[model samples]
Target: MTGYDDKPWLAAYPPGRPPHLRRAFSTALDMFDAAVRSAPDAAAIHYFDRSLRWAEVDRAAEAVASLLIARGFAPGDRLALCLQNNPAFVVGLVAAWKAGGTAVSLSPMSTEADLARSFAAFTPSALLVLDDLYVDRIRPILDTGDTGVAVVVTTSGLDGQTEDDPRIFADVDRRRPADTVDLAALVDAHLPGPGVLAALAQRRVGPSDVAVLAATSGTTGPAKGAQLTHANLAFSAQVYLDWSGLAPGEPVLGLAPVFHVTGLVGGVCLAMIAASPLVLTHRFEPAVIAAAAARRRPVFCAAVITAYIALADSPDVDAADLASLRLRYSGGAPIDPDVADRLEERLGGYIHNIYGQTETTSPSHAVPPGTRAPIDPDSGVLSVGVPVFDTVVRVIDDDGADLPVGEIGELVTTGPQVIPGYWHDPVATADAFIGGALRTGDVGFMDADGWFYVVDRKKDQINAAGYKVWPSEVERLLAGHPDVEEAAVIGIPDEYRGETVKAFVVPRPGSTLDVDAVIAYCRANLTAYKYPREVEMVAALPRTATGKVLRRALR
Candidate 1:
């Protein structure tokens, strides 16, 4: 019955591990500048057959900041970016922060309608989209005149790529959008100029200022923006950097997408904090990750469970490619214990499980490196692990009272890394956060040993391929079809993804609507991960006493 302030997990720390982190840096930009000054000539970023040193990255970020300012993006403005894991993503992220603006990350897989919804909600002043995606994705949204964006910058996936690389990049002249300017050409047009360096020095970002606006779904339906401050990003990065035990100029693998919080904090921000070189890949292909591991021999990497499964199942991976791996991290989705055991056997390293939300900025609970998690005797659930430095976790009941150990209840957390509130959504912010602690909608309990285990999810959200998919959002889209009378969506257990989206639809009387047509209609409006892969046609949807669809019964 003791409070978590006792920090019982400190007893489980590896020998000589510090109890907490000092968190020396004030902001993410400050950390980045310190890394550049400490190792100007050291490699900071690595792509196919090419590398960018710390000095080069700093100069490029400065030039991009100047371009943003000249394009009418003032301090505290929102800059939307739609890109994958590449050099351009990092460049744009740092540039926006340097210009004292908040960066908004959008999924590259989002359809035109999906993009339009987000753009209208956030009302970003500027946009940075991939060159090839601009034509099919951005142009349609811009034509509607819904977004407030006035300036658009298109970046090539092949910029700074080696000539020997295998991927095909579009020719800038023939395929480039007529209204947008090339990112590389803009940088070349502005860099090494007097104004660029002066602007970089003049703009000042504070620790409490909002640095990033990450999009996340709630139970209500559409995605809401989580306003993360500079201190939130800085502390999260420093916490993991100390946890990984990597040194300056070390090699780290960046396989996760930079847009997500895990990759943004663990992959990019952690590398900057440690002054390490991040080996980048455009997407998660087993062969490419295997080849990069063989060449770079990275010391650490983070990804979802499916990615680890793909690498372990691939024929190209072997002991040599993973020999240098000291620690591995898995987040966004739950990892089966058997899968973790098998992957550890292959890589000779423990795969730690991290638990957090987009609102937490990345991780709040993580298994200490080199240690294995214990299984609960009664529930048979594997513990996610103990809280990291300066974090407190408690299980609360319906009345906000602390529950005893082994009791299932809502998980609440408080720490420096937690975001203050949701962007422009006071109702959601007030509903989710209570007394400075985030009321995480996860039903879990803590053990006497201070370890935490997730028993179930309180929110009716689906984790498909490590992305949160709200059932209500899909139901709204499904109800729009003429042939559909009513719809209900639920998550079904999946082996590869933790869960897959499944829809139960009621066809209009005397109207013929198959599963294919329903899925196609959803695919045209929703993002790739949010679409329902399996559809069931029923005579009518099950209703409750009040005439509401019973999602639990459908499940």
Candidate 2:
């Protein structure tokens, strides 16, 4: 059983998923075969100005492989993909794999400094950049910094396109002196038929090799690449697919960025998990999403809380009758109780809570498929659900001892789904893992029923006037009130107390909410020190892409 204690209601882990296929994928290259096998023309991927079937996508990837071979790119060499959410992103990634190199995904929105920092950390030999993003911003940083990349390739104008000017996509291969090779021509030459044997021979790549280079701020501090084997990614994809229980060929929406784990796994890996067709709203535009929903009606979507909030408030949002939707899930941050309730009220059963971090690849927790919890009980619902398909959970103390039922402690996880360590940082990895379990750096406790509750980030705890207060607790209490629409609690600096609790609230529509009443309500639910000493009413609370309340931003 995933998290089942001796509880009466929630039972053991689902039976379909056994404790098999752990640390499974040695590489991610298998998804391409799976995609091609499942549906050659299943509307495999839809993105900017183009839609590709499985067969077409594979051909393009093979072309990318040939181009790398022509430049003498090696097997273990790294390739940085510094592009926004576009079809080229997938082509570059898959192509890098076909060519036997690792693709390092870079956030398109990252500043030049961050981009340079990332590039230097991995020392990718080449980069595939999008024309839309400010690629020039990172160029100066690369020239002045360490780890100078050898090759620069433009992905623009690759969709069967070529102009007389030919200025677009003039590949800058240092190995090939004179002019860069045309990528489109390379791909056209490799069209998957009798002529394909020649192209495949040139690239000479296959499975059992690393496909993606995953980098994150490792536990110790500096950025390090995880070296995700193709098997690891394939295993993660399989685990996520089972977690959702969606049909194999269902249409899923990709409305998030491709840079982060959320987008890569949810938007890319998960779509290929079961070879599902994907509908992409690349840049996450609210109007475009509404338009897509009105027209295409994708069956499933993996999104964050910010998108939910925006859509909920949009003039076009008609929760009563959403089109082409099987499930709507939000993660990346805690979902406010009030927001959750309103979404349920509007969209019927549109909102579900997913919980995970970059470490888990993507989501390791989600509401049960048929959960009947109400939105009014949001925090009660956000409690991380049962362990994922092949994951394990444990709550422990500083001495590395496991705590009993209902005891609060640092959440530690151990399972095939959890990465044992970060890239190139043994010290950080040692500090993070205890007895083979990764310490999540989150404060939480599991009830006897096996439901896990996230208390807060251990670092975010506040000491107000010598009393310990958790913002999640206070905010949860505030959100439960009928008049409160939304609430965010943070620590405000105090001369005498060191740090005082401050509550920023948004009142519900058609309610005259006052501070005295709110403070009085908190006083009834929380201890004296836990009550907000200062309350400020605002139009809205600041949030991240996934709807996580940006408590650090509140002044």
Candidate 3:
């Protein structure tokens, strides 16, 4: 018997909300099929000035699926997709599933080393890369002849968009690689013939089949892949739909990166489940997103708090441009109550807090639509809302004993949305999931009324603009430099971004370390968000008697 057994949060559920899902699709593919069947002519994707109907998307996915199978992409094979929030990403995701392959989500911002580490962790059989990314990142890897990737399909970010906004697309390379197959050409072929349909029919995807290998923060080590099955994706999508009460045919704004779990499930899968149009602006350019919102009149958007802060601060974006957003949810990082209030005042919508991890597929806790999240009086931290449908959240002590209400401890959760295990890593899987519940390294507590508030992390991980940036990873990268004797990284508060990476370094005996050069070195090696934005030259990092760096002391 634990404090969570009584389910105190149910009392606060929105009127007419069910404790469990009333209905859910067996898989994401099933959900996509249902949407196409219900609204063939409804807008499925709105990219820039172009809108692709449900039927159009279905046809394109089917054609691409056929092309994939013809290229020897077998069942259970993994298809690595490195792209931004574009129409092809949507088409490629459905196509991967339809062709009986697992979709591996890879960040477009990943550097060569980052990509190499990810590839080593999960070997993909086929790769769908954006043109510029192909030229800069993928081509070099292919030249090394190390990866098992057999089929290389490339596409341009300019595909399906009639108006190429110079803010995003002006520098985009539309050139197709001579060695790789063009995704646009495959869709143009429209080869979903009887043979292709028969192939798809033979390879039926079940709920238990892995849908996406979402990457997690390599806080302990290299970024591990959380194997989110079709069931996980389907249930998580339904939770978003029901918790938010997003109406059918309403446009869902795609402000988060599609490569991320938050954007994949909340933005893409949620839109598919609701039969809503997914409004995208290539990537998350605030001015462009504001313009799209004004034109499309999108009512729902689930993005990081940083994105909301940026959108609200953009001089080009006025309240009128964002007046259409009614269901705004922010997750991936802690939200400031003052920032939320000011954003609401400026944007005219409550910034509902949604909480989850890559292991949970997307969201396990979210503020109910039309309800305001409460702030913890003692800590002044805003609650991350209560557990969603069919979820059990409990706070436990170091020995795994259940903690009383309002006592800060590690948050352990078990839900339909939680992943079964990490892909190809049994040791991590065993360590993370204990007694059928995920031992989320997050430290938080649940109030008596069932509002949950996160206080800190059990690990030394930094959440910069909702992207996980581990200090160890940054420290290791810094230690690789010739001029650095030792380094330590920490996260510092930023007015706009929720947190930014800051590094403290010790120089070699005689070597002079230029601060700008050190920062530029990290910027060149690591992803934009992972690199340290601020660097300080220090004589030594505060350490304990055991010779371990005390990050809290540095903080």
Candidate 4:
């Protein structure tokens, strides 16, 4: 069997496409600068009813850098962004990088407890938040002194959307807080002062500087931050753009959430680096996406399997709506072979399967554009394609030795795009990454022809709605219920969600706990995607001789 150490996948690349990146940028900032210099007046972002040119985005980011510097934020400090797929999200991140601060991307769906935990862990000096959506959650966290957040910049979700958009809802005062600054006002403020510009010029970022604190579930439990350097983000964007053959000024759909790695790197960073226009909307509705695709004629889009399924099932989607699409890619979750075929049959284009974790930045493996993924003859599993430019994938045994091709073992990756390590957790960093390679905890194999296939996952994590749900966190929450004596959670096959959490519970002695009660209890304590959707009650949970729960038996 041919080994992958030589990157055999290069042979399978599309005609005329190089197997490696020919052009390089030292950092993502450099890439953005190049795009702005190349096309100052080109359309950079297309929001609901408003469009922002490259000049506008650049000036706004500079103002944000000035604001951060004026607030005493120094290099290496962390700035958290807790918004959705809005222009503010991009501006804030770029500004943070410009001011030499590491930006942290947080999901807008984070609960009060979730925000508090992250704030305590990262100790961000400032936050850019959606005013109407998360004011309450942020207020309490700030009051507790756990997050160390001194500055807060709030923006309305309707900043660029048409006034009649249904997604916009007002829950709190839109007025700026007495202490916090308004993002819109900052952007409209005069250009950077002499002092702020001086500070900005003095702050220099390099390829090795930490650029983002991407959140991910560690090997065993709770979410930990991954320290992705500027080089990691820059490499991911350049590789994706080059491999997809996306031309500058082409339109790409902004369907993925900005908080997710796929959106941050693939959608925003790729669009900026390619000098392409990113068409954006507030939410992911099938009808809306179809309408936008028909109107704007986007050439590329990357989304999860569920989004593709939704588009296929929607009545508004037809041949003309998808005619503009040159390429479509699926990430965040695995798509079944049958489902993938069904999508292609209905959507008129093949959906290439891309694989990566937050720890690997955004994408390490993707099928080359215009190429169909091959299926494993023995297992009938669809291949996840090949490693992108400059990436190395290896299947290894438990002892960290390379396994022969076609043998299923853990998949480890090493490349410029991989994050340096987990934030502030040396133990986790040591356990998850070894000798510059990340143990992906996925059991997969590569064929002699350089095609890769996934068999199963070694980690106890669920991908509900493309969100990582650690079983242990849910199990711990269930065990805290008054009626639950013990609980074991496992991921079950789900047609819509890829995988949903199912709990096997044992009731406390003399206590009555029904399935509905267990579900409701968990729904109250956990987030929507993290809660167990199905529950099973048993007399006692199966345990090993050492009194440990046998999760496999539960499954």
Ranking the candidates on lDDT from highest down gives: 3, 4, 1, 2
Tens digit per residue, CA lDDT, model 1, 347-407: 5678898888889998999898878888777655668888988899999988999998778
lDDT by residue for model 4 (97-179), tens: 88998999887777788888898888899898888555568887788766677788888767865644553333323656666
Q: Lowest summed lDDT over 10 consecutive residues: which window, candidate 4?
A: 164-173
Off by over 4 Å in 1: 163-174, 217-220, 460-555
Q: Which ten contiguous residues of candidate 1 have the minimum total lDDT? A: 165-174
Candidate 3: list runs displaced more than 4 Å.
219-221, 461-555
Query: lDDT per prediction?
Result: 0.80, 0.67, 0.86, 0.81
Candidate 4, residue 14: Cα displacement in angstroms equals 1.7
Which 10 successive residues of model 2 have the least lDDT summed?
160-169
lDDT of 1: 0.80
| Candidate 2, superposed: residue stretches over 4 Å from native | 1-26, 48-50, 134-136, 156-211, 214-227, 373-381, 477-487, 492-495, 503-525, 534-555
| Superior by lDDT: candidate 1 or candidate 2 | 1
| Ten-residue region with minimum lDDT total, candidate 3 | 543-552
Tell me the lDDT of candidate 3.
0.86
Local accuracy of candidate 3 as per-residue lDDT tens digits, 355-462? 988899889888888899998887677899999999989999999999999887899999898899999889999999987799988888999999998765677767
Residue 63 CA displacement from its true place in model 1, Å: 1.5
Q: lDDT by residue for model 2 over 119-205, one digit each (tens)?
A: 767778777775434245655665574775766666543442222122223452213212233345556676455554465555434
Clashes of each: 0, 11, 0, 0
Estimate the TM-score of every prediction: 0.82, 0.82, 0.84, 0.82
Of 2 and 4, the candidate ahead on lDDT is 4
